[model samples]
Target: MSHSFDPIDNQSNNEHFQEVLDKAFSNPSRRSILRGGLGLASMFALPMLPGCGGTSTASDAAVGAITELKFTTVAKSLADRIWVPAGYTVKILHATGDTLKTGVAAYSNAGTDDAESWANRVGDQHDGTEIFYIGSNGKSKGSYSYAAGDKAVLAVNNESSAEAHFFHPTGQTSGAAVGKKFDQFGQWTLGVRPAAEAIKEILMHGVTLVEVNLDASGKPTGYNATSALNRRITPETPMTVTGPAAELANLKAMMVTKFDPTGNTTRGTLNNCGTGITPWGTLITCEENWATYFTMPAGATVPTDTKLIASRTRYGVQTTATSATAATSRTQGWHTVTDADPTSRFARWNVSASGATAAADFRNEPQTFGYNVEIDPANVNSMPAKRTSMGRFAHEAAVCSIPVVGKPLAFYMGCDSRNEYIYKFVSTKTWDAADIGGGIAAGDKYLNEGKLYAAKFNDTGQGEWLELSINNALIKAAAFGFTSQAEVLVHTRIAADAAGATKMDRPEWGAVNHANGEVYFALTNNNASNRTPGKTDAANPRAYKDNDGIGRDGNPHGHIIRFKETNSMAEATTFAWDIFLFGAEEDAPAVNTNISGLTAANSFSSPDGLWFSKSTGICWIQTDDGAFTDETNCMLVAAVPGTVGDGGAFTVSNTMTVAGAPQTANQNTFVGKVLGESRLRRFLVGPKGAEVTGITETPDGKAIFVGIQHPAEEATAYNDVSKGVWPTNANNGVGGTYGLGGRARSATIIITKDDGGRIGL
Candidate 1:
């Protein structure tokens, strides 16, 4: 089953060394800095773009094929308000700390908010989101309305939060204080944050399911928290650890906590980032960069067990003794609390194997996380299940296409790390219309028995899916031996290495074109050390200096990559691919940075979040940029993408050297069709220090829901709070120029056409 193309062999020694260094330095708090890096159920049917082919039964006339974007692309802005097309208007449907239940007091927008009420309010750091419609019976009825009529439930992911001010009586304290700062990526300076505050921080890291109904004017309003379906799933929420690895003996060796001695359960999902909605009515929230949350105790021994060492090493799990130069450290220093007495509930943060059995100590606690967790939004009481079959890594998005009549369902995912590979999981079961309303039962059938595949793109503008199964000879080789399918899923990157999967720029959100079954991924920016010229490939073909924010060399402005399966089949092993768009300034050199021919109105960098409208063929691109922020804040852009092979193939230069000579030129790298302002436009620009992420919409295409994450993230001091004030319309210190508000908090905004018409038509 080996292919002639070998991606791993092409990696230079420097590239390999730097990758290891990158992994060694990665931590939870620096997630965006590290690399700048769903269920089914009673199910929301896969939305079909207006002119796309699918099962979506919207009433709007099909445009057949989206040729060009109709509305003028919104220009990039630094204003605090949500910007959109001229006819569109924005509303704050719900924000962080907003009371989900009517009886709870409104959020003070200050650090004085009650910690006990967090369970009844919308969580902080909103990242991923999806809107589900509910029927009178309290079950998911699904929605096709562009204007989302009446009953709807919004599932929001509160990715991560710093305990400092979130739970304190006054915003002054950051709860945990580290006396030593690394001043570098992987150095662990120990600080002390309160255990109670740490607990509250964990409580806010999961998903929030809130009930929503339109206001009198037909605009979305605050959540109905008291509704039976409103629920907050935090890290403390007990969830089943199901899948091939669920019962592995090695898995049990790390669970020292009393909560689940059997190692069959884990307390809460961590770093729940991009999310996906199942057709059968469930929410799949991805766990990204979950490793940094664990702390290596001060005197803990490094793992002697080769299997354990390999597992920890590959997943970037730092141990106590791991140094800045070495590959491990107490990234969060959360384990510092357990230093004196490592037996309390919070001691679970320590992953050292101090006990003989997994239940006796918390060594294996970290293994339970880093998987996609499924929750039934319709049933608040339903237990969430971690679907491990999809493979473990820093999961970004788990996007699924519309289920075809007899074809197996497929889910697309990206691991958000520099030089990481793209992945896909195909169900063993064929699509069954009878399972339309199957709920969790349907999820169990499809997600539990899928074949995980890593992608390998050829220099000839072609790619193939390499299966990551234990049965593969290379995977079972003496060097990379896998004991079971669970191991293959657990150590996916190693399996991908054996499979020769292509290394990409940091892969983030993935969107499947419903109109043609094409898949698009945002390869977020990379630094020069990793993306040096000699290491560039057909997929990651750019290496240039950014002229925008904090200008640096390398592919500072990332690009969008798209591929169409051979014969347009989701399960196809072969495919044709191309660069959909390269993120850059409108004036950047046309040769590399501006490969997509971006114009002023639609130019962007660090393309992070991406989602395609099921009602319109519009592909919404969102950014989380440190590279382009000097010019403007993070923004969202909309585009109507063409299928793969829409553009000509070309060669690019590689000035990087190996021993003493410059590397050869890159070959036959395929770029997407050059798009103009008519097809790509800046749809919205967020406030300062904010990332525009988590995008979803009503089936009718009339409404768009966008998640605003980490607004004013630069405001480190509790007192001054002047770095960036957002989401406040008054007293913003900008003389009311910023319309959103002053005190920054992540929130979700609902966008609708002021004319009551379909959005972006």
Candidate 2:
């Protein structure tokens, strides 16, 4: 709900402040006197006078007048460094294993940190983050950057991890079977060891909250370790379901208590990727790739919940051990850790059915995850609630609008898998200002009482929103056997399939344009398996392969799609749509590679992060990919986007030009491309082996923050130095052979102009 903070609403007051300051500085005589006094007085003394050398009043005016802005220039280019503009500075405000509570030592970075310390430190793989300014009264200002009497609380998602060696002192290989031996460790095989390791690994994943402060320069300066807002939520934390599942008494009992309830609220939030800030001022972290953390033991009896099994498969959870790969087998084996007992935390991670009844087996564990987890970052004592009304799937990101007083609120989301559809949840209840700081109570009103719909992009450049209601004929008749609305929401993919909702190419993130009320999503590359020969549709046209070992029938690289509400109402069912840009090589065919005049510098693959600046109209694009790393790592681009259908119609066909051979029409045709610098331009590049994802900005437009994930992911053995030492080189400017120094880590960076210029202008 929207709460009014009249004093901070500076539109009227800032003008008055500017008027007086302008009058004092505009006088020519005052300027001369200030310059003269500068030579005699200290730097700080100049600002004490009416027209002295404080940040020029003109600077404040420029920031205030910034109604339109565009991202310009590469901020910083770290060879192994995250890029920002020259005027901006970056600090490691909080790091993985950095204690959030007192009595915990600093992170050793040498794989010696204890689990208790990690439980109190920031979690690993920080992804999506939102800055919530805490007002003096302990309420959230909901502002992006710092304000007077405001203490900032950052709610960040810890996407995923590969720092196995650092998390465990002995390393995963310590007791591992030697040289591919499977049965050397008694009755257990090498594969079985991974299952045990998986349990421990799952405990390490989740969301983290830390309190950060701004320096005199208005940049993130330091983190307060003992801030009441600080917390770490891992898989071990106890969490409860709030919807239909909550009605199941046994399930409710398990949900209400944390794994160690007497000790902590919930274990942690796992596979947390993209997130949303509720109208109530709480954080909604989506659990993605969660199914991958579990395993079904071999020869285990299957549960009767076929619908559940199908749901698991749709989210990429394997039902059979035969489907396991080396990576999948080496998983933390949470199922086998405490296989002797069915009720132990270790056994809960195991999704296999060892007994006939649900109460006696772990088959229900998989269902516990894959739902959205809501956290009250400002209240450490609050237990995270999983709002089932939002529906469940491989949730990539959840984004919401600033709740309008007495108006219905909406949340937009995307299921991050090839061929998945975009979704939205419109609250049934209207917003009330009193609910602003209501936290979970507010969440129960808006998030827990909404209708879910999936997007369908048609061939005519128009899209429709398909509802996933239980009463829908398709859902009722579907093989998944949906018995109720709650069941339909939990098994949303099956319901969507029955409803015939169109599938997309890995819709990673959905961003709502605050300026125009349009929605944009990143379709991060779909493979041939998802596209039939004659089934390629207009919105997802151009299925081809490049010599770069990607996109063989859509193997790699992706594009972004944009659409506007039919009537500017979020509840509208119909809207126009178009491809905003295509990810491709600069030298590739004009039809396939070029979209809106994107060049090599700006061209990138797998667009993952999409955010529109409230202060500036410019759109920021961040990438996550393995396709373009040979040239450079992930990058961020700035775009001046025109609404859907802004570009003229064109066709695209794919063909090889070996020996200058001619191609057929089926191979290529016309498509649209808006040619110009204003359309799209590469703004920044990230450190080696890193993905440029997650972006947010200060409300005043003075600062922008971007996340750099998985730097040096290519390194295999942490002990071996020569593999890949990325962030160390990028951040410290120190380069040497592998493992020479500098260990790679995920981090977030802030960028701004030195002259106090508005960002993205």
Candidate 3:
């Protein structure tokens, strides 16, 4: 979905990465630059991203490199269809409204499905996906089995209701007739948000589990509609809230609602963006942008305790103070519906205080979201748990470090908003092989007890993880008032702010190299308001107007960053870092913008998803972009990434117009080895207006399941062809959109080589 949210990135006290580069890299021996891939430097580079194409030259065997990408570069495309290299083929396996039960009518592609029907249908806007099989190989069970009897399930996150335009017949009910389009009336719920319409939209924003069938060759065939384990986790599912927050005072007191008086459980999960496959055979679906679901109605008289006002203001759910934006910014207006029975399920969304006490009303509802939720796929009846110890924010992905026996495990995560902090949760319990299939019990043992730390990238290449715990004096004495470990976990952003964590450009998905322990994250661009001339620092070095014709100035083309833990320890508090790749259009300036030396073949912008194939060890980077859309839709690139500090530290001279004059400034930062076209090239491109995200390959590397989120997401009307017509061949198959005349849907596609060889090799 195109990002639509009022960001709570208003932080002033925290120290942004400052400039102190001269002494940071004083030691000359450690500086190194990769000299393998570059050719003669070109002063004038091309401006288009689709002009270059050829085979990749990346090494077939580096120190842990399992396989190299062997496919030809797929050119930039604007068509409404999936494009891959010459040998691969694409097949749609599952999509929104697809039936997951034994008996159901085919989705009309219209907004006519009954409200109760959504409970058994696949959700919309597919994001992160993980394939889990039942059998055991070693590391956490599941993945890769040619046996005919193996059970496999795919957990796909439905991130948002961005594509809700198609789910309804006449579009959302806005105030005016023009409100038929989602943009015109998306948040005008007070006008008329029918209970039925509101319920359907709410049900489509969580996660979906479907049983995938693999062929005899160990490649995925398709999803089975009637599998027993298939289900939709919507806003109504019962979820147990675990971790210290569930037991402590100030935080525990906030979890009460008429729906769950015990204060130990909550109802459902929403805005599940990215996912983490646990070492104990479970799935951790992260909640992102969940704050927009509730309305803090400007001056509505509600609970007067006022203890949560500070935390609410910091999180953008302002109660005592609300502007015109906050008044009507309720994403779906589910709160406007008048459901009278059973604690008024729809009323939970309107969080203004009204009843006698905190438990009487739903004022504390928003506090329940924004955490990493654990779900055990191996057990169909296991209840989901909100792992509050992981800390709450707009969680993107939770990528776990490679497990070592008797060593504490680390799960690296990024908050998906501009100026947000990245975090790592280290489990107190060491890895024990006995918990491989221990299910939710293993989650209780590890996830419920952990130490959460926020990242602090120093001016030097070295960085440290600032612990967000009561034991930390800084966290304990912060403005949010950390009374206990629970308050620190509940108001984690406030705690990280007090700990002086470094702010990063919208950090999206994170992935750990299976072969090596180095971790990678996608800094998916920043804007003019948050980044300025002198504010730019080493870790986030670029801040300039885009000279490209697209006119996205403020670091619109984002970059990928990687870091290695000290002494390769998962529990290390310090690490070294570098930029693995800088996303840019091929035609951008070569000196600073195109510093990674990308050609037309491998150029991409706004890397939002990062994953390493367990079978091939190939780092897969996916894009969710708006900067370079005129030339191409979002895409996925397969890479063989180099280690940290593979490139030397150098001064980055950026020219930005401050006030009315143009000025240039320099900052020192590190870049990893440049892969050129051969090592890093475009692997796949999605249909029009869609984000290419969430990818996972089979254990044998035969098939890769890629998610195309909300194809034609900007369509105003159901029949609007100018936006796109895809996954349907109604327009006689034109260059891009076939003009299929059908509603667009989010889906997962299976890509495999025609010759039955390993994908990307």
| Backbone clashes under 3 angstroms, per model | 34, 46, 11
Which tens-of-lDDT digit does each residue in 1-761 have in candidate 1? 00011122123122332232233223222111111000011112323342112245644234224556688667777655566677777777777777767678877765555666777777878888887766655556344333334577889888876423423444422224322222112344455545545555556678888887766554565556578778899887888766643434644444335557876677888888898877666678999877767766556755566776676766767644544353234354455453444335567777776777556666777778778898887777788987878888888989886568788888899988777778999988877756654667777888888789988765455678989988888778836567777778777778887776777777889987666567889888777666665555555666666655474667778888787788767688887766677788888776656777778888898888988776666788999887777777888887876655545433344444434555544422333456777778887888767888988776567777888887766655443346565666553222243222246767788888868776777
Estimate every model's Cα lDDT from 0 to 1: 0.67, 0.59, 0.74
Task: Please estimate how well model 3 matches the true structure, expressed as its whole-model Cα lDDT.
Answer: 0.74
The CA root-mean-square deviation of candidate 1, after full C-alpha superposition on the true structure, stands at 7.8
> Where does candidate 2 have its weakest 10-residue lDDT segment?
1-10
Q: Which scores higher on lDDT, 2 or 3?
A: 3
Candidates 1 and 3: which is better by TM-score? 3
Model 2: what TM-score? 0.82
RMSD of every candidate to native, in Å, equals: 7.8, 13.7, 6.1
Which sections of candidate 3 miss by over 4 Å?
4-6, 18-68, 136-140, 144-148, 175-179, 182-186, 245-251, 320-327, 649-651, 667-672, 730-741
lDDT of 3 by residue, 110-161 (tens): 6788877888889988999987777644222544222345678899999887
Model 3, total clashes:
11
